[model samples]
Target: MATLAEKFGLRKASGVGEAGWGHTLIVALVSLIYFLPVLMIIFTAFKPSAQALSVPPTLSPTSLFGLIPDQFVFTPTLENFGQVFNRVMVSGSAAEPTGFDVFFFNSFFISSVSVLLALVIGTLASYGFSRYPLKGNDTYLFIILTTRMLPAIVVIIPIILMFRTVGLSGSYLGIIMLYTAFNLAFTIWMMKSFFDELSYDVEDAARIDGSSEIKVFMKICLPQVVAGLAATFVFGLILTWNEFLFALLLTGVDTRTVPVAMNQAVSSGGRGTDWTLLASIETLFLIPVFLVTFFLQNHLLRGVTFGTVKR
Candidate 1:
């Protein structure tokens, strides 16, 4: 009887240990799955052209001794990143010059200008919607949202023609206008929700103190909705920075946006199809977005919810 009891106790301990080990293994596998793409991009970015195109894509391998051995070969080089930054010389218009310096400035200028314009205009539009509440306002809101739902590609040709007629084609103004229109719906809707959460009494109190409408908005409502504005600005900035379709179709040479330039680079297909270079460019592109979010992450979350509650 004593021997049987000991065997039973040992079996139960082994079963519990195995279950715990299995759970840990599952968690480690899930983490690896999430991290694999990031690892691949980083690895690919530094691979030499020949190795980059090599069949079976040697990402990671360990030797028999459980170490990455020197004999376990891989070609590594920074030339791909160099090419992405600036190509020495490539003939033809499609193979035109590409410099991170050029496209970065264009992207920054267009995105900043567009976001500023949208914030100003969209805020005013949202305030009006919240304050007035006139008949057909619901219809108007629907119309605004509907604008964003339209296929941007479908209208690109017409917009290009319109810009040409007005001498705005390929110009900064043309791109800004195109972006602002597309982004307006989201900004207005988001801002309106934030505005709706604020008490009407606060504005009424300001007016009673003889504050002008503009003054009230500037001094009172503006402070209350600063978080919403920040959120909107970030959203708008991301949209404009990453926009490719309109930038590609609308802008020419000097005015081309980063994504457009990147697309042009790949499409031209000389050293253009180089995935290592593509990976480096993508890394550069993503860094700004990552930094902005990382730096202001706390402020953004807090600001977006300032006037959200009814109290």
Candidate 2:
């Protein structure tokens, strides 16, 4: 009888061990190369503003001429983070809340609301497409997908004109609607695949047992696709959170998001770009995305593979 490792295909072939080690090393190196920029941003965020832009671009926080006398340690300050939130002192007085607070709130609110709307609408549409046959359904799906394929720039001018005509320009509702529309295509396509993978027996049985269509869909179908919903929510959140072009063109000062704020935060009144503060903003900006992905990582793994295997 074969061992469990062989049965599961987990055992390495006898001649390939050295080659596998080489491949692993190559992958590790490539991953580090891609991660270096993120490491740079994190390092710069903690450094003093002067050292952040220092010549020769040292990654170490300490200098040879430091007070600690060549020790590799330097004090990391929260001043950069404070500056991001407008908490830094101004001429010995405490600073007031600048628009950064508003920017942060706007980003959170818009991204959350838009993703929720997209998920709700897209999930329903996807279920209909998966379970209910319509004439020219594939053609309709292809048409919806074509909207995503078009470059945003190609549509922006017309969308802007339409929004202005409808008095939707610079409004939260307008941006949210736009984001929902953009995300809807992706959500539907992704969720439809998951729904297609489900067995129809359960749904059919529920229907035969006097369950209404709404009750069967709500209580039975939706529960089984939780993984897909989590995955779709994360993707939709990311698409809206990092979007800059639409927000920049469509939103006013009152509704600008963090990506727009990051652009404004880069310059400091003709004193060149404030690299440290920008790094601070980027570091904070990554937290919500990171947290969401971290929490849903297991669901994401299952979601992406949900339909690939057959029992």
Candidate 3:
């Protein structure tokens, strides 16, 4: 009987026995290298402000006698996180709130709504293109893609002017609209590819069973492309959440997103950057994206490779 590894065509490293320990060691090393910066951020987030800026950075918490420089024996504290959320005491009084909670809400709302709008509109458009071909369908797709190809900076001036003329500058709606527009081209192209890869047999069978076109799309076709939708939503959310230029230029203090707030938090009051506080903010900022990716990891993996395999 063929072993599992042999059946899967995964051979052990030559001359290294059947365990592939050498290959496993190499993969572990590469993963560690990739995660080193994230580990540093997390470590710094728990350090005191002074320790975070100490000469020759140390990964371990600082001890009174300072254990060996490389030893992980320092004490951990929540001072930085307290400062990030304005929960720290200042001069024996409760510190004023920093409004970080508002920034987080703004980022979440804008990213979620923009990605959903793009997904809905793009999915319908993609289905139309895939199922109902027209004389210039390819040309239309290329045109839509060209919108994404343009440098965002190149069109910022005109967009700013248009938003101002429409009295939409600095409003949540304005930023959300811009994000949706930016995400639309990517959504359309990606979803269209998935739809194109789907066989027509299932859809045709549904049509023959007295299903309306809309019913066929809603009940049959949409379910088949769920992985693709998940992948597109995650990418679009990341892009909009991290967008700095548009948020900086178009949003007011009341509507500012986390990225813009992070920049201000770093240099606010011109008192120099607080490395520990910055790390704390970065750690918090990573949570939502991490959670979303974690929950959707299986779908994301399938979506990315959906069209590559052929039966």
lDDT at 187, model 3: 96
Q: Please identify which of the two predictions, 1 or 2, would achieve the higher lDDT against the true structure.
A: 2
Q: Evaluate residue 275 in candidate 3 and report its C-alpha lDDT on the 0 to 100 scale.
A: 87
**Residue 136 error, candidate 2, Å:** 0.3
Model 2, span 1-311: residue lDDT tens: 76543443443443234567788999899999999999899888998887786665656666646554443444578898988877433467777666788999999999999999999999999999999968999998998898889899888999999999999999999999999999999999999998998878878989999999999999888988888999999988988999999999999889999999899768645668888889999999989988998998766654333333457
Deviation (Å) of 3 in candidate 1: 54
**Any runs in candidate 3 off by more than 4 Å, and if so which?**
1-19, 61-73, 87-94, 303-311
Q: Estimate, for each residue in 1-311, the C-alpha lDDT of model 1 and write its tens digit.
A: 34432433333333434457789999899999998887777777777767776766666533446565544446667777778866755455343346667787888888888888888899999999998887989899998898677787886878888888998888888888878887788889999998988878888989999999999899989888877887888887888889888898888787888898877776674654767777777777777767876776655645433334467
What digit string (tens of lDDT, one per residue) describes model 3 on residues 86-165? 84334677688889999999999999999999999999999999999889999999998886787888778899999999
Q: Which ten residues in a row have the lowest lDDT in candidate 2?
A: 8-17
**Per-model TM values vs. the true structure:** 0.76, 0.84, 0.86
TM-score (C-alpha, index-matched) for candidate 3: 0.86
Model 2, residue 42: what's the lDDT? Answer: 88
Cα error of candidate 2 at position 180, Å? 0.5
